[model samples]
Target: MNNFTTFFVSGWHHIVDINAYDHLLFVMTLCAAFKLKEWKQILVIITAFTVGHSITLVISSLGYIPDNPKIIDLLIPFTIMITAISNIRNYGKEGVFSNKNVKYVIALIFGLIHGLAFASNFKVMMFNDNIIKPLFAFNLGIEVGQLFIVAIFTLMLFAYSKILKGEHLKWNIFVSGAGFGIAATIFIGALS
Candidate 1:
């Protein structure tokens, strides 16, 4: 019985697993949304996403609404494509908060949708013991996973910035387009 419980508990770890498609898409979208520089901007965007996801995740998990995992699964990819589009449009812009707040706002909104996707899994986990603690822990794990991926991406971009010097924008477009394409594929696949 104890082993079974431990196995079940371990499964919650996947909720935040960065390698997971949903979580990866969310992080990619957020990272691609804003031009990278300075930890403050990253913090603002990440915080907004976290707050948004946490709100909906907690609400849906608490039975505020019966969340449909399939719907959210599809929407998650759409959110990624939207964010990638936004990023592609805003490439090479300056000022993190000057009018870019709209993008972050969208991030927050999409974050909520992404949270709904998570709520499905969390709701199942709720059947176990100490629901609140596990839920909070899982959310924290997600944040950790997001931050880790963002940091790696940032570092990679910084390195490329130093290398290419000026061609980064072109690369950004290519990468963002790739992300959008991948997202679109996922969304379509989910729908079909």
Candidate 2:
């Protein structure tokens, strides 16, 4: 592979890595409350997160933010837990597009935390003299990975919606519960 492709592919794999799935879990939880019809809102939410992580990724890559992997490791799952719980609490009351500002803010904040985690690895791996190209490629790769996850999630939710025949709340609960359980496990593992 070419140099650019190498960096981009590395970033994609890093985010979507099955063994290290905190990022995927976060994306899943963030997108869980929406239906396939709410694609616009989902795009906005995903953009918020991308912007958030990009800000911190750039800052951290420039050495402005310290790489605190342990703290970030814990905070990552905490963000997931918070998002999952929010879905569980607001499942029925809030429409898919309601309170979007709130979701955007959460996604941004959590994305910043997740960016720090990304930076811990990025700083070590990035070797180019001009950081802009590789950094942009890496961020692009992350967005692609995130969008892939969102697409799969949207499809799964759509299938479940059809299967349940309007009992989508149960699907939401199941996704949230699973997110919560996984986040809790990661949070505990980070502590140990």
Candidate 3:
């Protein structure tokens, strides 16, 4: 019970951690083009990501694949950059976000890559040989954290639309651009 609680909290803290904001940036980029009314789509995407993330996390945790922290680290930022570029390219145009299946598939695939990014640290936190309970609790915590992030962005989008009267297209471009820049920098840094 205690270990479960610890793992849950660890997952939550890791996702929401300001020190490592890559995941947060990815979620923000995903929500950049969306508004509050489109929450069902957002939730489905987030859940799809979690499912993919959980699969890789479990596989990596069980020692099925050897960990390559460097490659995974590079891949994580690359995912964010790709998503940001997609958001930037499609914001004003009728584009990929409108296609539900593609959106979820992209999120799920990116989640798999992001799960590998988390694998090394999660491995360090592994308490024992058996990881089922810890993995479940940790993934649940991440899911909740992801929902919280989506909610914040949704409200922010609402506020921008209502209070600021800023167009979502501009917001999407701005936010996605920032995400792209950050991810590019991180990706470059990882390379060196």
In TM-score terms, candidate 1 sits at: 0.80
- What tens-digit string does per-residue lDDT give for candidate 1 at 27-104? 765675445555677777876887787788678766797867688778888888877877777666665533557756
Q: Give the TM-score (vs. native) of candidate 3.
A: 0.92
Ranking by lDDT: 3, 2, 1
Give the range of the ten consecutive residues with the poorest summed lDDT in model 2. Answer: 91-100
Candidate 2 at 190: error in angstroms? 1.2
Instruction: Give Cα-based local distance difference scores for all models.
Output: 0.68, 0.83, 0.85
Ranking by TM-score: 3, 2, 1
Q: How do all models score by TM-score?
A: 0.80, 0.92, 0.92
What are the clash counts of all predictions, listed in order? Answer: 0, 0, 0
Better of 1 and 2 by lDDT: 2
Residue pairs with colliding backbones in model 3 are none
Candidate 1 local Cα displacement, residue 168, angstroms: 3.6
How many clashes show up in model 2? 0
Off by over 4 Å in 2: 94-98
Residue pairs with backbone atoms closer than 3 Å in model 2 (clashes): none
